[model samples]
Target chain A: MERKYWEEEIETMPRRQLEKLQVERLRKTVEIAMGSKFYAPIFRERGITPESINSVEDIKRFPFTTKNDLRSTYPFGIASVPLQKVIRLHSSSGTTGNPTVILHTRRDIDEWADAMARSMYATGLRDTDIIQNTSGYGMFTGGLGIQYAAERLGAMTVPAAAGNSLRQFKFIQDFGTTALHCIPSYATRLAAVFKEQGVDPRDTTVRIMIIGAEPHSEAQRQRIEELWGCKAYNNFGMSEMCGPGVAIECQEQNGMHIWEDNYIVEILDPVTLEPVPEGELGELVLTTLNREAMPLFRYRTRDLTRILPGECPCGRTHRRLQRFQGRSDDMMIVKGVNIFPIQIEKILMQFPELASDFLITLETVGDNDEMTVQVELAKATDDFQLLDNLRREIARRLKDEILLTPKVQLVGKGVIPQSDGKAVRVKDLRQNH
Target chain B: MKTIKQLSIFLENRQGSLKRILSALSDQNIEIQAASVADTNDYGILRLITSNQTKAAALLSDIGVLVNVNEVLAISIEDNVAAFSATISSLTDNGVVINYLYTFSKDGRLVLIVRPADMEKAELVASAQGFQLIQGWE
Candidate 1:
């Protein structure tokens, strides 16, 4: 018989007991954070000692950490423990600026795996399952982070790190693979490959899919579920707080249950920097309570989501978070209209005639700014009227949402460049002029 | 029922897009018997009468180019203005409208490739007028 919970004791802990654990861990995290070169002076200036955190609410008094702090400190300044004690490090891509690094002790790596294991178990993956991880390994934590968790869950893991869709199918058939972990965009592209190769995904051994590392709409998730014939679960995690395991959706498939035993979750207005009303949309702020090598104190995640109100049918005391809307930094301003890429994605995915890939281009036309949305058609058609109608419908739907008409172009499949890495959805050409 | 198989390809209005499609077909040794490009500022459609369209469509699609196969009327006529006008008037006088038409000349023989708004009407009119309609390209 399958088990009800991964760690029933911790997962189903009472609310009062959970809050007590959070307070105790919060104090410990504050002390650990003070040991770092990055937080020592800041803690002194803010008069924040371990005793300053009486309860989880006291976390509001502590100074909020930003990405700029991580960048300014560079590679090792954020480590709470000595460099000699650290066993591993993961750094994100620094396309915009200096790469922010997260250091981990041997114990920290173990705990990260344990957390990820719990998340996988919540999605009904068991030791009997063969998990194939398709995320790239190395510095990208999704690769190693998920790999360790699958191993910790006692599942047979195939570390088929990223790309080479042909080999992925071979492993799925030959190994009798039962689960897959990959980003959402790559998941859709994989579906296309499955079609091109004439493989019926529903007939395969796969039953569960864990998709993350990019913001996707509910429509997109439903589309993936229909294509892969599996229960697609949304995973919410950032490298700052161990990747791929901080939160996960259970079989209920309602909202992602954030692991409260390991971290304190806070939702705050991005501009006001104050906590929003319960169940209101805001930026997610996190503080690590279990990490040893680097215990980030009130680190701002910049991701926009809301803590779902009320209890989940699954009965986990930990709070559930709605799927991330978009990053605060990812919002684009076009002619005084604020728009998130996910908003466009939500509308596009609703249409079955369209493919998963799209590119939003902002350009300067004469003295005016114009937006053009280039999306791919799922298949080629000789009917020009059908293509024209699709373009107009997409434009009309976008105008209804954004209040500005964008020039919508329906292009051929594979016209927009798709890479093994994250999909680049927006291109601002107005910067050139 | 007598119609020519034409491959209509979607091409983005950017540098090297047409070249990429042409090079892919060229590498496969696919002969392009006739070609016409309908262009706009953002994108264009390249229509072609190929020696082996089914093979050409499969090859181009495999290379990530969008190709659609459709049947368009191909009428053989004299390489003169009068012959061209007569063939077009035969369809228009029978209440059929031509959406688009492109011509190709080979060895003093002119062929008008017509994509009529109403294909059934155009096919009946061409057959009734005894116009030499090319069925499948050699």
Candidate 2:
């Protein structure tokens, strides 16, 4: 075996020592945060300084940074370092408002690559492995993020940017690719193409699959695995947290190991804004502990997930995060009931008759708010009773999960619009009078 | 037992949904021999027998329509109240309950398309009563 750990000393650091490092970095982060124009005034108003942070728990003392805060600041508003020092920047698509920009210095970029390389290494990817990145480039972080990491890990990289499945397969075969990085939906779509081409994925050169960027249920992961004949690892990251490499699943394939050395993770009830019990689902809050150019303080990811209670057998002291349930921001309040799209996805995936594509639309009817779920059938059926039973079962299960019965619509395959990037699962047209 | 192919389409209960499927099939020169719609507030199931069942289905599928092709029993009945009643009563007397049925004319002759609870038995009963059966698209 060619060494188990990438940075063995740090990866296997004791819990007590990891906490000490977190506190030390937390203090440094506060000092660096003071340099930013966005946080300078807030810190000064509260009399918060580097000396104020004594432990990791002190992260709560700082105000929670929401997406709105990042929006109001706009481009270059949150940079702790000058523009000359920053070498690169990645931003989230702001369809409703200003897109949040994350500035990265040369050192910050190198650290990001290091974090990603460490993540890939944990998954047993080596220098000899040929990595194919299918994520979109340019504005999307998943592109360059994985590219740099694969190169950093000394692996051969094929930057075959998203779409053009024909070209993707060509590259995979030509380059003898061993691993693929893509979103969960794209993975399912590629599997369909594999079937159409009469080429079994197991017979192909690829063996490892890394999927992230979109929220997916455990059932979806299992379906991908079965289709690809390989292990589909769950990955978690956001553009605000420097894209992917923030957390990844090791060979154990249980939960994602968050890079505690680079981040301080906290799970809190989204509504109450208070810390929830460990191993319980709550909105994941992340604080960038190592980034130099733009370190975020208590950034509310709005993603709902729980921390696994036990230590991973992989021996990495970094805590594991259960696969995300859904984003808190994606929660829809219809008729006094809270429903998340992932909840609907989980129920739909249980049925082999339903395709992975689905859309949830909330509309206003007179004085009542109604929800309709449109899902595509995996395969056409000649029996009306089978379809009727599937639709009724979906509605019944949804009612139990969401406490509201949504009108379930079974659509034809390929009816739902497919986005090359993150999929839009919900459309709320409810007009509040 | 002889049977004809019938297309069961899932159509959303909204304006132009039916028109979209109809136009798509017509554009491909596929004729609708008989049609019946079972509808609810949300959506409808459009049962159609076409001149070219295979061609019509492929065309509808290309335009993103959910279609299910099923074999149904189509019997030619005389153009008279007594003949229609006697033909239907024969099947009922033989313990065959028609789940669904629709009618259309072929060369001035009445054709009754039926999906019964038991298709194999219904086809036998119709044939034993000396009724002419329309099998396949032709």
Candidate 3:
């Protein structure tokens, strides 16, 4: 087993050495951005100087790059490198609005693969493991990104793409897949299929199941483990910040460890844009330390999370990030109370009967914004009254868990639509006046 | 006094999952009058018409299915080949593109489930053409 790059660096370098590396990388990144046509004007207009930003502390002098900025510069506006130098491009879902395109050079691709390899190592995925990649491919980075890393880490890669559960199950059985990478919801569905097929996931050779893309709760993780009989790992990343390997849960199953050597992460107040105190919930902001093609300075990810600044039990010195709370955009104000759909999902998935597939409907009932949770029950038993009992149970759970009384409508299995790529969990029906 | 209610139910792409809801309704003795399924790789929308709309909705809700009830005009025809083509021509003549259509029968009535480009215009054209537009809830 090869020691991770960060692990090696932390063990060898003193605090000063890491600080120096960050300063050097930051300086070079700023200079590259200043020379670029896209960012030069913005920085010049803001009266910022690359020379003034000599250290990590001087990072505050730079302007923040947002999703709107990426959208405004759509297609190929933010390309710091020439069009010929760029090798590949990835994009956001754009379901909320216009998709943001991320361009990567060959070097960027190598770094991304390295980062993912680090993540794989952190999860104890060995070279001997037959890693199955189930994330959606093409334009989306999840499948390809993880594939490159798994291959780089010496793990035999199974590029399953997405969908075709029957084929996926066959691969798991025949290929002797030890590690799996996919969305948490899909992982749950796979487990359900395993149960329905009467296959024991525990008895199988599968070891680590890595899940990402969506914010999954601890309860959901436990359920997946119970169903699959494997240890489930949570992964966190976005297309803008490179892909699912930006952060990963170590074998300890503590918070996901962020690769601070390559990227600097901060939690800030969504409104104020000021760094929040440690342990306080805030929007996550990131700046790439060594990205050449598209280096983002103070990029607002819109994902809300806290930084757990400490050394991990796994001996990795890189800073760890808590699981994402919710997105700034997904936050709903119901009767002046701010609620995130992930919060509701976490509460609902605690029940064994309820599947991760649920819908949050927000509509204007009377003068106020009314919220309803339409939960999809997994399976139907011989007892019909169990349906009513499940609804009441969900209602009671929501009341007790989230402290909000939401109208619980038990939706039939398959009633809630699924997505091969990004799962659209919350349906906000409130008209924007 | 018999009327049929059309419903659009969104479904996730999972095997044998739709059977749960359909079985629930079947257990209540409610029969599906007409049905069609439009599917993508990840999700499907099951469009249905039942003998009893209120009972279907209640049974579906009780079993925890998100059912959206839609009112669609089911035109009773003679089941002749000309009758079906004439219905299509009539809508085309009125500049209405049929969004979706399905044919089925109940009792002696040969029903054409017509979803036209314009609901109001389709209603007017059907009424003007002397075809009885099914109205009210079952």
lDDT by candidate, in order shown: 0.88, 0.87, 0.78
lDDT by residue (tens digit), candidate 1, B1-138 = 799899988887778989998888899898888999987676778999998899999999898887889999999999999988887887898898988899999779999999998898899888889999888765
Model 3 agreement with the true structure over A1-433: per-residue lDDT tens digits: 5655435664335556776787788878877777567788978887766566666777787778899999888888888888798899999878867789998999999989988888888888888899999988888889899999998899999999999998888999999999889888998888778777888777777889989888777888898888778999998878888877788988889898787777777788766678878877788888998788888999999888887766777777667788876687787777677676766776787888767778888888877777788886664332224556777788887777456788877655556666653356777887772
RMSD from true fold, candidate 1: 9.6
- In terms of DockQ, the best-performing candidate is 1
Which stretches of candidate 2 lie above 4 Å from their native place?
A332-430, B1-138
Runs of candidate 1 exceeding 4 Å displacement: A331-433, B1-138
Candidate 3 CAPRI grade:
incorrect
Question: Quick one: ranking by lDDT, best first?
Answer: 1, 2, 3
Candidate 2 chain A, run of 10 with poorest lDDT: A414-423
Compare the candidates by lDDT and give the number of the best one. Answer: 1
Write one digit per residue (lDDT tens) for candidate 1, span A1-433: 6678989989999999999999998888878877888788988998988877677888888788888988988988888888999999999989889998989999899999999999999999999999999999999999999999999999999999999999998899899998999888888888888888898787788899999988887888898898889989999889989787999999899999999999899998766689989997788999899998988878899898899999998978889999886687777888988887767887899899888889999998887889989998777666667778888899999999788999998787666766543467888899643
Give the per-residue lDDT of model 2 (tens digit) for B4-50: 99999887767888999999988888888899998766667899998
Give lDDT tens digits, candidate 2, residues A24-69: 9988988988889988999998888899878888887789898898
Q: lDDT at B77 for candidate 3? A: 80
Among all windows of 10 consecutive residues in model 2 chain B, the one with the lowest summed lDDT is B36-45
Ranking of all candidate structures by their TM-score, best first: 2, 1, 3
TM-score of chain A of each: 0.79, 0.81, 0.78
